[model samples]
Target: MAGMDEAVAELAAEHGDLDALLAGLADDRWLLPTPAEGWDIRDQVSHLADTNDICVDTITGGPRPLNEEALKFPTPEAFTQSGVDKGRAMTPAAVLDWWRTSAARNRDVLLQKDARDRVPWGLGMSAKMMATARMMETWAHAGDVRGALGMEPSATPRLRGIAFLTLRAVPYALSYAKVEQPAGTLRADLTYNGETWPIGPDDADNVITGDALEFCRLGIRRASRAQTSTLKAQGALAEAALDNLRAFL
Candidate 1:
């Protein structure tokens, strides 16, 4: 129910924060390895920029088709391979600049569109969904950067929307991981903005509770289960949920 302007502003602000973080890093820092396999700081930035380009193409109804190519890869392994190949040759500064420009263009398009209008991105999502996806991407990649640099990222209240959306998609993410939870019952309690959003059954033995940002980080697999104090998953359901979890399909 959030408006386009609000969504765009939140996403754009996160983009600016990410840009600042990338810009402040030294060349050597950019070369440091991240949690993402075979990718460093530069690759993470490039991937974010590449994502923006794809979003822009989708939103504008451009000539490019929103197929596997635009979406990049069907699997995380394939996506990482493509990013490694593309990012190996790029300079850090170039990657940073490209992301800045691409994100700005996407922001402009979002600002111009109706919030409810449908945009043909991968998996058929509305303009608001596209914006939310962008926000999720920013948060996920920011985790990659944070992991590499050993820095802690502050939680953004606005990201609660994306986090809630992600919870709804939990079953889908689990399916992608090729893992299934027991039928009985389970609940995930996520806290943000001084409120708790529960996902799953009311009378469930499994419960995953955490700060919203940490929950997002764990869901994306950017932060290892051992690294987060905000997360507490009880029973086998919690463990099953963590295996091969990913934000993007």
Candidate 2:
């Protein structure tokens, strides 16, 4: 429960950050297209608002059918675009309010969540895993919004939560490619701002070492392994996981 409180608090802080970022955006900025291809700021908020409700439902009860359907979309892009069509009827302010409402509910869930709770995120994950995924996702979309507005994403320790999730997802990453996970321990060492954050066994020969932000970016599919040229892998499985890592698959 100590860790749950921490993860929940981190998630809450990130959500507040995102809400503040959008709260001051002008109407025109709301219409700006983000790094998510066809999605504008409004669409991004709509997606999160919808997913926020799903997150709370997963904890407090169950996700609605529409939300459940969105999760099953064949591609991440498709899933993001699914709700925007009908959502277009709503004003930007209305949409933002909708997102805020769900986010509020999510914050409540964060306060009350326990370790035994689990959400069917990606390939079935625990409540803490769900919170981490939500935090990473909100952070990623915030980057998209910032990119659209010609703003820079502020480097922060909060990113470590996402980075930690990426490091812990090694097995899931390998499974995505159906790569035969090699036997033996695997290690990943991430260096960010002069500090080295390591995961897996220190004695393991097989390792993936790189920038912490780059590793988190890789998990969200924001940046590819090649783009983060700093990353170096010493084993076949580690390399394979690096190539195919995705926060959601």
Per-model TM against the reference = 0.79, 0.89
lDDT of 2 by residue, 116-143 (tens): 5656655677878778888887898888
TM-score of 1: 0.79
Q: Least lDDT summed over 10 consecutive residues: which range in candidate 2? A: 62-71
Best by TM-score: 2
Worst 10-residue lDDT window for candidate 1 reads 63-72
Stretches off by above 4 angstroms in model 1 are 63-65, 68-76, 179-188, 193-208, 224-245
Model 1 over residues 124-217: C-alpha lDDT tens digits? 6678877887888887888789889897765777657667656656677778767774554557788888988776778888777887777787
| Candidate 1 Cα deviation (angstroms), residue 85 | 3.3
Residue 100 error for model 2, in Å?
1.5
Q: Evaluate all candidate structures by whole-model CA lDDT and list the values in order.
A: 0.75, 0.78
